[model samples]
Structure formats: structure tokens, C-alpha cells
Target: MRWGTFTSSNSVLLLIDHQVGTMKLIQNIPFETAKRNTLALTKAAKILGMPIILTTGTENGFQGPLLPEFKELVPEAYDARIARSGVVNTWEDPEFRAAVEKTQRSHLIMAGVTTDVCLYSPALSAVEDGYPVQAVLDASGSPTELSEQLARQRMERGGVTLTATNTLIAELARDWSRPEGSELLKLMVDDVLPPVF
Candidate 1:
């Protein structure tokens, strides 16, 4: 996979299946940390004006809706909450595909609950469909460490760029001179990452 920076116009952020029940199943990382990183990523994307897609899967069933905290952060982005009948892969959902197609962006920055399912499946599909997909590792979680590790390997093999929230923030900033650069720095220290000094 060729590495490149993210420009607001060329990239879109996807927050998928971040439902309450799903969030409770993550065992590889602290649930609170994953939620925090996910929120930070969303806030950074919002500040940089990146096109975003917020989605939930089987919300009317056991998974529940997108986390209220996340919804509160990106209230303006297109929200796709799948009803009782829904596909596990959001990419398989017509509404999701339509929203992605409508964005016209070639690069996708994605993070979600259940790294093995919600994060990996669509990432592979998007790559197959010709979109460069980047998965924010720390922002996604799974039921077990082994599950998350295997999912990461599969995604990497399938041409998805496995990354972290900080990397995405830096890629979007690219230059310290840009006004958002400072905001990015503040986000890094204050929210997305641990403070240094």
C-alpha cells in the first residue's frame, strides 16, 4: 500500500458500529480508552472539516445505537442506524455505500467496534472496490486480543492501512503552518494522546 497524507477533500472518516452493547464486548483495550480515542478522532476530523459517516448496525436488536457520546460529537454527519434487519458489514448496506459514493473521496479513515467484523470486513471491501482504507487501530476493539491481532493481519494483507488516531491527525495536519495544526497539537495532548510535559 502506498502511503499518503490525508487532505480534507480527498478523504472521509467512517465511525462504524460504535453501539453500546458492542462497546462493552471489547477486551483487548480499555473500553473507555477506545471510546476516548474514537471521540478524539471524530473531533479532529470535524475540526479539519473532513467528510464523515457515522453508522450503527442492528441497533434495534442487541447491538443498540451508536454511543450517545459519539453521536453528540458528530451530530451533523450522515447517521445510518440499521434497523432490526441489517448486514454485519456496513459496506454491504446500500445506505452506507451510497453515502460513501456521495462523498467522492478516495481515501477512507475508519474506526469501529469489533475490529474483526465491523472494522475489517468493509475495509477489505472498500479496498477491493478501489478505495484506500485506513483503520485506526486504537480506536477499534474486539472481544479478545487474538481476535484483534488476526483482524489486523487480515486487513493488512487485504491492503488496508492499519494505523492510529495520532497518525491520522498528523497526516491531516501535514504542515505546522496550517492554522489547524495548532488545534491538532492541542487535540493530541489534551484528548487523543497522553500529555507530554
Candidate 2:
């Protein structure tokens, strides 16, 4: 697939199933690392004035509600979040699909809990629907390394571009001298990056 650069105006952030219980299932990476990267993506999107669509699957069940920090960070998205009752693939949910369509942006930057299920399914669906997707791997994980690896392979094969949080931020920022870029840099240093000893 020929890739186009992701700009703030051309991309939308899709955060799926970053709920309390679902988050606990992430074992391919440290829980804190995933959480931090997810938050960093949220903060970066806010800085760039990018559209953010937050979704959760069966929140009333084991999935649980989205993390509290999302509400505190991006209140508008949190308020308008898509709470799926039983939809495993977020793209299969009409409201979630509509929300993505409503954005009208062609590029989707997505991160979800349990990469094998939550992130994989919809990412492929989005690609099939003719949308270019960038799955933020560091912000999403699976319960095991094998699941994570398989999900990554499948998504890559399905034409979803895989990226990490820092790369996505830099791609969106474009220039460090700009105000938004500066703010994003601070977010990276303070939230995303691990400390250097």
C-alpha cells in the first residue's frame, strides 16, 4: 500500500476498549507502558485538534468502563464515547462506524485493548472499507506474546499500517518549533517516555 503522511487534519484517533478490566488483560507489554502510550496519543490528538472517537465493548460486563483519566483529559470525547453492549469488533457497531464516518477523515489512528480481538478485527474492517489505518501497537496489547504477534501480522497483511506512539506524535507534529509540536514534545517527555538514568 502506498502511504500518505498523517496530518492532524487528515487523521482521526480511534481509542477502543481501553477499559479497566480489558486493560488488565494486556500482558505483551507492561500495563503502565500501554496506559501511558494510550494517554500520550490522547493528549497529542487534543493538542493537534484532531478528532478522537473513544469506544468500549460490553462495559457493563467484564470489559468495564473506560479509564477515568480519559474523562479528565478529553472530556468531550469521553462524554460522547460509544459504549458497545456486545460488539466485539467496533467497526461492526453502527454507532462506532458512524462516528468514524462523521469525522470524514481518511486516515485512522487506532489503539485498543487485546490486540488480537479489539484492535485486529476493526482495523482490518476499516482497511477493507478503503480507509488507511495506523494501528498504534504500543498503546494496544494482547494477553500473550503469540496473540500479539499474530494480530500484528494479520493487520499488516490486511494493509493496516502499524506505528508506535512516539512515531505517530512526531508524524502529526511535523515540526518541533510549532506550538502544537512543542506541547506534544512536553507530553512525550512527561508522559510517554521512560526516564533516562
Candidate 3:
């Protein structure tokens, strides 16, 4: 796969299944760590003025509603969130796919709870459908280390670029001196990074 840079103008943020009950299934990383990173990405994306697409799976069932913080951070995306009835792979959901297409962005930055399922399937599907996808690993997790590893390998093999929250933020920012970059750096300090001392 050829390497490329994703800019705020060319990329859309797609957060999938970051729902309450679904998040509880993540065991590969501390739950708070995953939540924090995911929130940080949301804030960073909002600061950069990127289009965001939010999705949930069977919210009325076990999946539960998407994390309320998203609604507070990017209320428009949350309000327009695609609520999948029973679709496991978000890419297969027509509404979700259409929403992403409507963004008119070529690259996708995605994160989801339970990396093995909520993230794995749709990411691969998106890649196969010819979209350049970047999966934010730290903002997502799996039920176990083995599942996470296997999913990562599969995603890599399937052409999804695996990335971390800080890396994605820095890549998008490109220059810390810019006002948006400075705000993103502040987001990193306040939400994603530990104290320097």
C-alpha cells in the first residue's frame, strides 16, 4: 500500500459503536484510557473542522446508546448519527455508508469499541470498497489481547492504516504553531497525555 497524508479537508472521522455497553467489552486496554483517547480524537477533529460521522449498533438492545460525550462535543454529528438496527458491519448499513459518502471526504479516520468486531469488520469493508482508512487503535480495543492482535493483523493486511490518537492528531495538525494545531496540542495535553513531571 502506498503511504499518504490525511488532512482535515480530505478526511472524515467515523466513530463506530462507541456505545456504553459495547465499551465495557474492551479488555485489551484500560477502559478509561480508551475512552479518553476516543474523546480526545473527537475534540481534535472538531477543532480542525473535519466532518464527523457517528454510528451505533442495535442501541435498543445490548449495545446501548453511543457515549453521551460525543453528543456534547460534536452535537450535529451525534444528532445525525446512524442508528443501525442489527447491522454488525457498519459499512453494510446503507444509512451509515451514505452518510460517509455524503461527507465527500476520501480518507476515513475511524475508531470503535471492541476492536475485533465493531471495528474490524467495517474497516475491512471500507478498505475493500476503495476508501483509504486509518484505524485509531488506542481509541479502540478488543475483548482480549489475542483478539486485538489478530484483528490488527487482519486490518493491516486488508489495507487499513493502523494509527494511534496522538499520531493522527499530529499528522492532521502538521504544524504546532498554527492556532488549530495549538488547540489540538492542548487537547493532547489535557486528555491524551500524562503529566510531564
Candidate 4:
């Protein structure tokens, strides 16, 4: 993806099934890291004011609601919760479609609980539909690192833009001199940049 060029205009973030239950099964990145990284992305999305949409599958049966941090970061996101029966592919759900439509943007930044199941399906479908898609890799995970890597390869082959949250943050920042400077720096140090430092 052309990073700054495309992301600057028609990009929306889609967080799929990042709920309590689904995250517990993710082993590639421990549940804790998954939780932290997901929240990091959420924080960046909110700070950047990007169009972010969230989804949950069968939450009433104990999947639980989205993580508390995410809830607090983007409370307005409640209206975007896509509840589905068994549409493994989030893109297949009508509610998901409506949420995406509401963004009024075509480029999509997507992440989900399970690397292969939750993340892959929509990415492939979205690409097939001719929409530019960015898969936020660190924010998505599976039971094993190998599986996660393979799923990433699969998404890559399908023409999805796979990237990290830090990359997205920097891309959105465009130039540090912009008005989002302090906010971006806060996100970088508090969430995106610190680990590497």
C-alpha cells in the first residue's frame, strides 16, 4: 500500500471479534500482548479520529463484550458493533457492510481475534470486492506463531496490505510538524514506540 497516500483519504479501521472469549484462544501473541496491542491500535484510531468499526460474534453466550480499554477509548464505537449468528467472514454480515458504508471510505484497516478465521476472511472478500485493504497484523493473532505467519502469507498473496500499528500511526502523522504531533508522540511513547526504544 502507498502508506500515506492511500491511508490519508479513504481509510477506515475495522476491529473484528476482539472480545474476551475469542482472545483467550490466541496463542501467537499471548492473551496479554493481544489485549495490549489491540488497545494500542484502538487508542491510535481514536486519537487519529479515523473511522473505526468494531464487531462481535455471539457475544451473549459468554464471548463477552469487547475489551474494557477499547470500550473506554471509543465508546462511540458501540453503534458499530456488528452482532452476527455465524458469519465467519465478517464482511459477509450485513451489519458489517452497513458500518463500513457509514465510514464513507473505501480503504480498510482490519484486525480480528483469530488470525486465520476472523482476520483472513474479510480481507480476502474485501480485496475481491476491489477495495484496498490493510490488515493490521500485530493486532490479530492465532493459536500458534506458525499459523499466524501462514495466515499473514495468505492475506499477503490475496493483495491485502499487512502492517503494524506503529506504521499506521506514523503514516497517519504524515509529518511530525502537523497538529497531531503531541498526540502522536504520546501514542508512540505510551503505546507504539516504547517497546522498540
Pairs of residues clashing in candidate 3? 115-141
What's the TM-score of each model vs. the native?
0.93, 0.98, 0.98, 0.91
Tens-digit lDDT string for candidate 1 (12-121): 99888888889998999999889889988888888888887888877777788778875577766634433325688888888788888888888999998899888999
List model 3 lDDT by residue over 1-197, tens digit each.
87478999999999999999999999989999999999999998899999989998888888899999987899899999999888888899999988999989999999988899889899999889888999999999999999999999999999999999999999999999999989998998989887898
Highest lDDT, which number? 2
lDDT values, one for every candidate: 0.84, 0.94, 0.92, 0.80
Q: Write the per-residue lDDT of candidate 4 for residues 63-121, one digit (tens) a residue.
A: 77777776567878865577788789999998889889877987888889898889998
By descending TM-score, how would the candidates be arranged?
2, 3, 1, 4
Most accurate candidate by TM-score? 2
Q: For residues 104-170, write the lDDT of model 2, one tens digit per residue.
A: 9989999999899999999999999999899999999999999999999999999999999998899
lDDT score at residue 80, model 4, on the 0-100 scale? 54
lDDT of 2: 0.94
Worst 10 residues of 4 by lDDT: 1-10
Clashes of each: 0, 0, 1, 0
Model 2 regions more than 4 Å off: none
lDDT of 1: 0.84
- Looking at model 2, the pairs that clash are none
As for lDDT, the candidate ahead, 1 or 4, is: 1
Which 10-residue window in model 1 sums to the lowest lDDT?
76-85
